[model samples]
Target: MATEWLGLHFLFGAFLIGAVLSRGAGEHLPRTATQETRQVTLILLLPAYFLLAGLRVDLSALDPSGFGELALVLVVAIAAKTASAFAAARLHRLGSRDLAVLATLMNTRGLTELIVLTVGVETGILDGNLYSMMVIMALVTTAMAGPVLSGLLRPAGGGEQPFSGETAAHDEPLPARHAREETG
Candidate 1:
């Protein structure tokens, strides 16, 4: 109804309706039904969504003239996201491995980027060539996130502490005395 009547994107409308419905009736849903819905969404709907997005992509719009600009944009986007996340984590005194993982995750531009790009094209805010480049950028950044996070979180020489609660160097369990002092 939002999509047809209000000119909103189908994805956006569905998300808004789902959020509203969940707030009102999520706890009333049976656990099994929720689990099955999640499974179906993941196993079927998500793949179809990506396939449709890929089919809609216009590869012919990727011209050599804009290749350099696209590359620069991609680099800037990834770097800015990672750097900002890393800096914020540092301010919070997150461990090195945790900081790296956070930065890598922050660099990912996945479904949200696709939604924005789709809307931009629809509204004539981006030309086909620019839209294609941004889509490519989003794909590359999202694809890189997993591998980069694994590498960053991997222990070096099997000596480094893992980022888990039991092993994190900077996140040791607080002594009762210190905890009381801080909280009191």
Candidate 2:
């Protein structure tokens, strides 16, 4: 209601509401509840949103002359995002595997990118061809995150466990004891 009244994008309004709600109630939420919410959001809402975005894409608007521009955008976007994440991870003294995972995750464009592109198109900041290119770039970069992280964080040998001790190699999924301590 507030979103429509203010002429705000639905995604932006939803994000704002989520941020506020999380700030107010996140810690009180049970871990399993949070996990279930995330799983449902990913499995249901995300695919429908992306599919809608894809359907809106005007494939006929793609110009052959724009191929170079598209490639440039893709390269620059990926490089800039990954490089920034890598630098930040390095500054934090994270391990090589941790750095790779951080960078790959940070580089993912996902739904946020689609939301931005949608706004851009609606506002006349981007035409059909540019929007198409950016959408493709988002999809490619998001898709790369999983494979890249898996390759980077895979166990060094068949005998090695993926995680060990109080300080695992990756930054995500904090050691169980550490997580409990933090939560408490």
Flag clash pairs in model 1.
none
Winning candidate number (lDDT) = 2
TM-score of 1: 0.78
* CA lDDT scores, all candidates in order: 0.76, 0.77
Stretches of candidate 1 exceeding 4 Å from the true structure: 159-161, 164-181
Candidate 1 lDDT over 9-82, as tens digits, reads 67678778877775547678899998899899999998897787666678765677678878998999888998
The Cα error of candidate 2 at residue 64, in Å, is 3.1
Best by the TM-score measure: 1
Q: Tell me how far the alpha carbon of residue 91 in candidate 1 is from the true structure, in angstroms, after superposition.
A: 2.4
lDDT of 2 by residue, 45-99 (tens): 8889789889877767657767778889889999999899988877755666677
Give the C-alpha miss distance for residue 2 in model 1, angstroms: 3.0
In terms of lDDT, the poorest run of 10 residues in model 2 is 159-168
lDDT of 2 at 100: 73
Off by over 4 Å in 2: 23-45, 158-184
